[model samples]
Target: MAENIVQRLRDEIENGIVTNQFAPGDRLDEMQLAKHFGVSRTPIREALMQLGAIGLIEMRPRRGAVVVEPGPHRIYEMFEVMAELEGMAGSLAARRHTDTDRTGLLAAHARCEHSANADDADTYYYDNELFHHAIYTASHSSFLIEQCTALHRRLRPYRRLQLRVRNRMKTSFSEHGGIVEAILSGEAELARTLLRQHIAVQGDRFSDLVATLSQREAHSG
Candidate 1:
């Protein structure tokens, strides 16, 4: 129950504040969160410590936990490392994937296409995550899979924000289409290149989209 509380609190933070609402250098109010989550301060403290370990939050002496917002350079630096990791996973999966992995990835990509065509952003996001997880599983490296998944979880908020960009779902589906084909055809290099490009986050629109969403949230609040 205690761990569940910690996980749930992390989910709330990931979906709420970390997604861009808190922004860079924004302070996290522990008392407010404790009240909102209907839990004692202990679990909240535990959850914040986990987030800090993951580089998603920082603990301060006087102000408690604060959201660690990545600047443009940090975004680029993180994505640069993530790209290599993803590319390596894709490459390995091409050689190591099972029939089951291919089937699941294909199905997920198909659903992503359907969802995007229907303009269902929510469903698209769900299926998109499923597709990536399939690739990670296909890689057949426990260490790589675990590390890749943790980083993916940390990046979820920003990725979710980026997905809301105009026609972003459609573009993502097209990218996935290429990735699926390359992987199916056992084209390791092709899959590697496409996967890295697919997850690339340094583009101008990514930063702009986060800023736009933050502005909207501020105005609405």
Candidate 2:
């Protein structure tokens, strides 16, 4: 029962089923969710506790537990951090990855190409992530992979949203090709610079994308 309830909660949170219905900083009604899950408050409590530990939601005194949003500035801050981490991964991957690692990355790149050509942005999003993850793992550094993946997960929602930017998927796919070429040539410095810019550059489109998303939500609401 406990495990089932925890997994259910995890799925709901990860799929944005709850967040879509509730705003950031809003308290979660434990009784409501417990009822929805057809379970006692015990597992619900356990789930909330676990989420709090992960920095997803915060448990408060009287107001109850609320989801935390990183707000505006936090988005740029995360990108800055991601740029450095990804640059390091690219640098190491260029020099250290096995031939098989290069093969896996090329496969992921092919998937991205197919998805982009199809205008299947959702599929591209998934493949793009896999491609980046392949590079990170290619570094053969467990500690680096773990840290990079954690940060990537935290930034997942933002990255997911950016996939909707006009023609961004195709542009991203092209950039991925460049990175792959650099890595294939063992150009560590070139790979690092390209990877960092690839992750960090919104290129005059950041505000437009932000505006579009904001307007979209307002309209949908």
Candidate 1 lDDT (Cα, 0 to 1)? 0.79
Give the Å error, residue 150, model 2: 1.2
Which residue runs of candidate 2 sit more than 4 Å off their true CA positions?
A: 1-21, 30-54, 61-65, 202-207, 216-221
Q: Could you give candidate 2's per-residue lDDT for residues 67-135 as a string of tens digits?
A: 876555776787888888998999999999898998999999999999999999767878989999999
Can you list the residue pairs that collide in candidate 1?
none
TM-score on alpha carbons, each prediction? 0.78, 0.77
The 0-to-1 C-alpha lDDT of every candidate, in the order given, reads: 0.79, 0.79
lDDT, model 2, position 188: 93
Instruction: Find the 10 residues in a row with the least total lDDT in model 2.
Output: 13-22
lDDT of model 2 at residue 122? 66
Instruction: Superpose all Cα atoms of candidate 2 onto the true structure and report the RMSD in Å to 1 decimal.
Output: 4.1
After superposition, the stretches of candidate 1 with alpha carbons farther than 4 Å from their true spots are 1-12, 15-20, 34-50, 201-204, 210-221
